[model samples]
Target: MKDIKDINKATVKNKTVPTTTGGGVKKVIYTLSTIQRIGLRNSAKALTSHNACKACGLGMGGQRGGMTNELDEFPSVCNKSIQAQSTDIQPAIPNALFNKHPLLDFQELSGQEIEHLGRLGTPIYKAKDSQHYCEVSWQEALDRIAKAMRKTPAQRSFFYSSGRSSNEAGFVLQLLARMYGTNNINNCSYYCHQATGVALTNTIGSGTATVSLEDLNGCDVLFLIGANPASNHPRFIHKLKALRERGGKVIVINPAKEPGLVRFAVPKSAKSLLFGGTEIASLYIQPSIGSDIALFKGIAKAIIEMEAITEDFIHEHTKGYDNFLTNINATEWQEIVECSGISREQIGDIAKIYAESSNTIFAWGMGITHHTHGVENVEYISNLALLRGMVGRPGAGLLPLRGHSNVQGIGTIGVKPVLPQDVFDGIEKNFNITLPSEKGMDTLACLEAAYDNSIDFALLMGGNLYAASPDQQWTKKAMDNINFKVFLTTTLNQGHVNGMDNSEALVLPVTARDEEWQATTQESMFNYVRLSDGGIKRLDHVRPESVILTHIAEQVLPDSQLDFSAFRTHNNIREAIASTIPGMEKLAEIGTSKEEFHISGRLVHDYNFNTQDGQASFITHSILRDEREKPLPYTLTTVRSEGQFNTIVYEQKDSYRDTDDRWSILMNPATIEKLGITENSCINVRSAHGVMNDVKVFPFDLPNSNIMAYFPEANILVGRDHDPRSLTPAFKSVNVDIEVVERQPSLSTS
Candidate 1:
């Protein structure tokens, strides 16, 4: 085993490849033929898995395939493959990590190793040089976690959960955290679509998608905004295909160029699989990052001028149309075109398609949510739907295609820093306790607390918070200041590897979504409540998060008012959740079944709302733009490679740009030239707290002026003070000047 010092010195090769010409891209797009589509489908239909290396021609097995080192190499190779697939090119190293995991100390990685690590992460702390990590028992780990959270000023403690938890475990975790006195529940939704949920609920009186499966063929237009369902949520592609079959027009807008928006292969559909995938988006528009607000604002302006607004619907169900129209009228067309980077004719064409349609469905992803002005963009998207009465219709509504399967469901169950007014009262009344009054901590808040020494402890339910947050050093230092930290994960990551300052900080490994959770789980789309039948037992060493929380609660709050032990059975937690949240009332009775109960909203289609006066309230949004524009040469928006999810480096390959996970900040060629940076220049991305040096440069046609830095890496540049609205840590947009720097010495070969 290598010593921590020696391992820290392990060098990685983070290299760059040559760029291709624009003409080659044009030839592929200009010559789309009927027979080519047929052949493509046939090739897709014949796709299957293999056991050998798909890229480097490496074999999988025996001496080299030894489990010990092989486990560490897997995520690196996965990241490499995913990068290649998304970018349409290959990496210099052929494959990242050769099959190693993504956990690493970035600062010391060699050029070769950095290629596989994907993002820049350096493990600041390790238990020992030889052991690398000391596996603590489940009990010892959770006990330490519970103690830390209890010592914190309850208000400073943060609880970050993931979508992989079973409902039984999710409810218990949330209930226990809240009972301990803080609503600082930060889930993946804060980054994905808290804006969509909050905005949709305010405008339509419902936060969920109003359209059901039956409504797929009921729409005239399927607008794909800020979402890529083909690779992210492939299960929902049938709906889009069905709409096209019914003569519907589709529209898409995103910063990165994805093959999915242009095409998709349905692994499940026989016809779709046999016939090559159907064209999902009829028109594709690659808009600049953080420009969604202006783009949608342009659409709304056109709708109003063309008299596309449904006057009858507005007069009967809305409150702020006149004020909204006034703001729309105030906008200049040229400003919208310049800001959104969309031609007037294109905007007019989208407006015409929308006007011609009787029903339209709008769905978005993180592209619309990561900006400082994310909330405003979501509201603007909702405003477009409301102008034509699309909110509650069968085929027209807002669906923020969330990442992580049940990210929405977990929020539905019990993951919130600040519970809604009703749930807050219900929990207090039900538990016979008055919860703490201070505004609970959120993601950025927790980071600030860690840095300021306000929080003595932090609890991570099921996320890589340290790696996912902006300004990696800010969060890293914040954790160091804290008395203790807890990470609940399936594999080692930058958090456990680097964030821990005290040996008191512990890491607890658990099961993933594909395995039996020993409890019930939920998905936003199917099987609202899925009961785990104990399909295949995981190694005894691993346990569900719910079980961990229960034991910890028992040990820490031994005599608390609530019977924390009841959580041993996931069903008990579900029943408890059902009692307070009306949506889950039948969860205990329904158990697990093939049938997934659609979240019921009686007023959704009826147009009756729960707001004051039973009508939807609208906020007349004045278009707000990103004020910080220091990285003026280009605008960058980080879009995930098709093979990865969130911060999990399942693959090192990015197919779209034909690259690997080397923590490279991709920019537009024009922006790079304007800034006097070479194509493969090494630049230091300087921000408020510090600088991340030795990051490679790859120029592409993403958002001009904005540089789209990949997650876990770019997040390192975001400051703790950035995420003001939802405390999401402005991961989407950051104001920073790029300075070209000389490359650091190689750690591997040296």
Candidate 2:
């Protein structure tokens, strides 16, 4: 095994002059290394068995429950699946270790070290005055939690969830929150895809993907905007490969110019892996960060000038075409170029490609959502698609590629502040309980409420809320204000240590999804639902989240209208889900039939929409301007490294970007030279939120006035700036001032 010193030295060699696009030899090597790190023998089942990849929302796996993809081919897993499953299946950390390392000791360790501490073995507790956490019995833990929760009113308590959970678990947990007479239930989506849901629903009558997985295969053109599927969603590369092989065109639009999207070596095909990778983008467009709306509107204007509009389709299936055209014509060419950072001719060329393609799919990621005008970005993209008749067709529509494995499913199960009236009616009639009618708070609202001491209790199903949130200092302070914060998760994260202001904290260990005693369900970005037969428990004391939530509900709400005991059975939860949730009627039968299904009423293959008028709407929106009091030299956008998933750092190195140091920021080489900042120079990065000193600077291909930094770490510089409509934090367009600082001397004594 290589020593840590050797690994650190190797980082210099590993650093690429320009980052490799996505999957290739490095991904394969990293995958094997992680598998070896966790012991290949121990992870054999997780890799070879039938299960869903917990990495992204692409929904890859054996269609019928084995480790294969929906195509039912064996060994269809990717590097991400291996890394995530291996890390999860590692041996539990013994209770003695917690005693050996006090709370302060654990707090002093780095994120990488803390991640290497292994799985949480047992339930633990920290009292109001205790300096260290002590192991506790399940009964005692539940009793204490029930007592703390009982003291707080339902309106003052909130429930937060991550996309990692199963549909059964999310539904039951949210139901518990609503049954407690409070609608203050929300999921982590408020931080990521909330804009996508809100915008798509306004335009197409549905918030999710209109096209199915099969639609992607048949599409002739794909506008893969904002998202970087190579590092973030590796399995998605396979789809791009298939699309290219079928003579399709993929136009990638992202500011960073990711290597994988430019060209990729997919391991699925040995030929492609052994030689050079398959080409991904036929055309790549890089607009200034948060300028997607301007770029898209420019394309719309060009399409109109070229007379490529699908007039018949627009007239028959759309509304507000005249007003949309008027707005496009009224907009000046110079304003578009200035805001979009692309030439009018270039925009016309892109429009020409779309004009000719018979079928095209419009897709995007957080780059489009994490902005003040995020809703407008989505609207502009929809406008372009509507002009070209791209939506509700056989091989084309809108797809907001989600990040979490089951986040969309969580929303479908009603994990939001407000529930649809019909769904609420179903729940009330079936469960014999009157849910709270008052307005509920979202993730940001919850934090603000906590800061004001209006919220007394907080329950988290999964996700590192503290680290994942923007403005690290504010988030920590807000979290600390809650009287009691309960986190039910599989392992320890930074949130456990710093993300609380609560007088008391509780950490309840939960089993991984593949280890649950009962089967569960997860929804893919494509709306297909898969069943996971979970029977591989790694720890003895750890319990499934459903079991924990049920027990907690039983203890906290003994006199409630529903029977908490009935929820112990996963089947009962699914039955309730199928009967109450719209378009999910098949869930009730999943347990018995063992059939993988797709939720109805989502895939809009025809012109018939779910909207009131059964027609799509065209929305006009205004462009954003620089409103900063002191304009910074560069805008810093926080991104995820290739080494891990959301907030979970499996490896400190970002192999794709070729940076081993997580504290490093990527910038243009010319800009670095112009500023007289040499390579490896430490710098102080300041934003409205906070300041991060000693951040390493490196050369990379970014826009002239833009730079990139790793998320969670750089989340400190992110503030409460968000889209007014969706409340999703504007993480991609943060204005920051950077100044070179003296480089720190190495502390190593070799």
Candidate 3:
């Protein structure tokens, strides 16, 4: 509600960065806070440090953190040290290895474990506090995992999957877990997109995006709700920028007005540079955090009042149309306006544009999916899209913006405990076995169980559970309670270095997608499975995830019992994925190109209703804005910044709102004045989960009454019980009462 120029500490127009050797330029904003200055100084220190990049574990390539993006005159004081890190200790790719057969080692995968992993993977561990890791062979590691799985109770055992895995590998892992007896399989989606899946599918017939990335070109109106594509998914900028140039309208809705949502100059575009770049969004709607439900309900109401409803489409392809309309209009306009922090006129205008556009796309980021009603919000969008027949049309559809490439792929592979019956039946028929019918636990359920000691052996496929979960202190303790733990990862991250480890915890190094996996084909948000074979090979001493998982299953249970050897060979596993899932059958063949692979058995991208009755499913629910008064003085909103990826932490000194590491919390100016807090004042943020101390505060770009917090740091403030339907932790909604710390606490405990 204030001028950005006055609030933003830094300006982009005053600074200029290189676009490229030809003539591409990108404008980035930053504040000149002491925190930023110190961070920049420390970065120069680390770039010149003896340590690794700490994010991707890539040895400091001669470039300084230095894989790419290195320049002379820059890093002058720090370049030498960064170059030393990349070339010295252990080469990312040794010169001798480059000359060998594959040009890259098939087993040198220090992978992601090298930097973030610290010193954990040198010889590996049987548990914490081991004297020395006598280097174990691949066979030995596999045997150890297998032996542990067999001894552990199936019900007591639990699985954690990361989005980094491929379809073939994920499918094999899920199958192995189900075959083991317990259906308690959990993937990263439980933390990120589970709500979106539940919400969208119930509203429309399908869960994934209705249109492919290629379909964006023809979109006439794009609604970017609770999303910032520039920092999260840069590739999407190409599509959005193109849409803008075509005279299309883009509406961005969020608690904070992200600069990327308003404008972006793509360094990859040519015509844009000639014209000094086109504007990205036509209007930016700043709403209160966790008020997405209210916002959507208002939009639905407006569409109805505007008479934009496709009456024929609703009658022919959708059910419960009348009821849904009734629920949408059930709420009073004044209440919606007060709750959403957006005007009634703004809501109606966006809906008018949406109903008028020939093609429209609604894309949302974590902001929409990280709440208690994340699923409900997703379903709301789907039903809204269905009303206007936006889905299954060119440049128009529901796009669930996913974090970490191919998290959707894991869903397609059915890693959930509640495997879709049709999917389970299909896979069981192919394998000729009766799969378990029990629904399994999600991330929150698994964590709560672990706290109660329900989980026996826990295996994390690629995430840092201890750090990623809310109520960090509690989550960390629960992890330690597990009898056994195993992580299949590329890097040594924060979670790996300081998490709970019982007597049987192990870290297995695996090749990153950047490195070549013999039989792996990665699926993107579009469900496009691309084989990333640079003709490169996995490193020595390391294995592909599929290979590692299958080998472990075989060691624990032989082929006579499960025949996991078939899953060991990548091709066989690919075939298994093809047969088990309806859409994945196309990946049955070997390939080295980006191929359009089917994931859902139902027809999509053309709006063919695939419900049991061959109609789009519609849910009519009244939007209930909890005007509940917060007992606390402040409300905390978590957010992702432009510089970092989700939980990956690539090291950016400045945040999207404050641009300073010192002030971890960004408050509205009015909120700050109301609370009587000063800049850089230390305080505590509390929610149902727990409380946090020493968090810095800043007046940011958010609306009054909303406080913008960051992840991993603010994650602990969100509670597990906040999730509405899918049991996914609602990280977005947290009412925190902030007050100055009277006296500093002891050094160690948070």
Per-candidate TM-score against the hidden true structure = 0.79, 0.95, 0.82
Model 2 whole-model lDDT (C-alpha atoms): 0.83
The best candidate by lDDT is: 2
Model 1 agreement with the true structure over 416-470: per-residue lDDT tens digits: 7777777778777877977766677666666777788777666776656766776
The segments of candidate 3 whose C-alpha lies over 4 angstroms from its true place after superposition are 1-123, 126-135, 270-277, 501-503, 534-539, 559-561, 592-595, 598-603, 625-629, 655-658, 741-750
lDDT for each residue of candidate 3 in 1-750, tens digit (9 for 90 to 100): 011002234422222111211112522222223224435653344344322122211112221222221122222222112222221122232223212312012212222222422222222554455422334566667777788888888888888788767766788788788888878887888888788778766766567777666567778998888877666665466567778877898888888766655556555455666665557778888887777777888888888888888888778877888788777767888878887888998988888888788988888877887777777778777877887888766767888787755577777888888888778888778878877777677777887898898887888888777767888778877877787788887655556544444445677777654343564655555555544332223245546778787777766656434588777666787777777777777777745233434355432666566667767877765555443445665667677665455665534444334355623777765555555555566777777677777877655667777887777767778766556686777677777777676333222212
Residue-by-residue lDDT tens digits, candidate 2, 662-707: 9888887666766666668889899988998898887766777788
Model 1: how far residue 163 lies from native, Å: 2.2
Error of 1 at 304 (Å): 1.7
Compared with the true structure, model 2 gives a TM-score of: 0.95
RMSD per model, one decimal: 10.5, 4.0, 9.9
How well does candidate 1 score on lDDT at residue 284?
81
- The top-ranked prediction according to TM-score is 2
lDDT of each: 0.59, 0.83, 0.64
